[model samples]
Target: MSAPLLQVNGLVKRFGGLVAVNGVDFSVAQGEIVGLLGPNGSGKTTVINLISGALPPTAGSVALQGQALTGLPAFRVARAGVARTFQLVRVLGSMDCVENVQAGLAFGTQNLPQRASRAQALKLLERVGMADFAHTTASELTYINQKRLELARALALRPRLLLLDEWLSGLNPSELVDGIALLRSLREEGITMLMVEHVMEAIRALCDRCVIMNAGSRIADGPPAAALAEPAVVRAYLGDDDA
Candidate 1:
């Protein structure tokens, strides 16, 4: 009934003569977890970059709750209540885990006082299962732990929209279960998310709907099972060796 939380219309990106994203359009509703599924080089990440202001769109518009966001810098996007994790998890390697999260809180949408920020950082680390390693140097953390820490830092931004770029990339089976639970909890707390994931099981378990892309275009958009079953989607992403 209300306007969607995020709207992207005719979005395009070009690097010289190559059009990385071509007239892609999608909308994410409040409290929805929408999965972006595509084969490699289908421009999924480019779409995320455009939406998050990491890359400027060559055409079209991006808006959050009717507030225009296209062409704004990445930091401005973050301050506009959008937070994202990278395909490669990034952290302040020299700093302790809690301190890394503290930095996110200090410079986020709603900056907090030093003491309050530290307390909040600890709470966030706890939520991400990193509280036990609060004092560990970030560079020393295992890859999976680094992913959790990155998530905590993103949460510190206090964002209404979270863009997750392959957050489920390197988890074991047990870790996958825990990760799914954490995501469900965030959903319960009302964080709208746009996730780029290759893992079909996670998509089926977590997504209310999915948008399937190929060659810089959207070929299917609907419930995960239905969209994934589309003949075109199968050819684009899910066929046997050859569709």
Candidate 2:
């Protein structure tokens, strides 16, 4: 088979004496959505930070279509076709929605012209259900709308691989349903994704596979149902007796 779209091998991270991520390995195939599953403080976000260049690894490497991304700065990694959202919502609070997405298009891989970027930004906002708020300032948006704006901006990067860190968190039931549908649509449009998520419904609806981590190490990797059913994953999420 062709190489996986994104490959992460033996990924590790450390802060002085603390090992935030411990030798995790996983890959996301082109056109696939892989869920990164783990409870809070399980190193899932640390993995995302390492892969996206927000943090340098203590060891291991990350590659995109066989090109090394290890040690590159975040912008360079982004220019290499990887785009990500943070666990906490991040937006250009002072900018209007369209301008915020336009900023992404301006700084992303292609660096489109202003007019073209503006047009594409509107399209991205519409795709994420924010077209009506194009002129609204991001700071004024509700929390979920701000999340949608972030997604739109990330889409503005036109990335081949997307890393989403809890992008589905804090949504109500109906919004969660829409969020899953939106993610599925993005996958259908050919964006490979590795998402760190706790919402079981979204995972079941959107993931083609899952990689479960616990206390900085991987404990399961397989189809979502099978992986989540693994004894290690059960123990990590619940307790020893539950497993």
Candidate 1 per-residue C-alpha lDDT over 102-185 given as tens digits, one digit per residue, 9 for 90 to 100:
888876856678888888999999999888999999999999999999999999988999999999988999999999999999
Which parts of model 2 are misplaced by more than 4 Å?
none
Model 1 earns a TM-score of 0.97
Clashes of each: 0, 0
Clashes in model 2: which pairs? none
Question: What are the C-alpha RMSDs, in order, of all predicted structures?
Answer: 1.2, 0.8
The per-residue C-alpha lDDT of model 1 at residue 225 equals: 97
- lDDT per residue, candidate 2, 16-99, as tens digits? 999889999988899999999898999999999998999999999999999999999999998899999988899999999999
- All candidates' lDDT scores? 0.93, 0.92
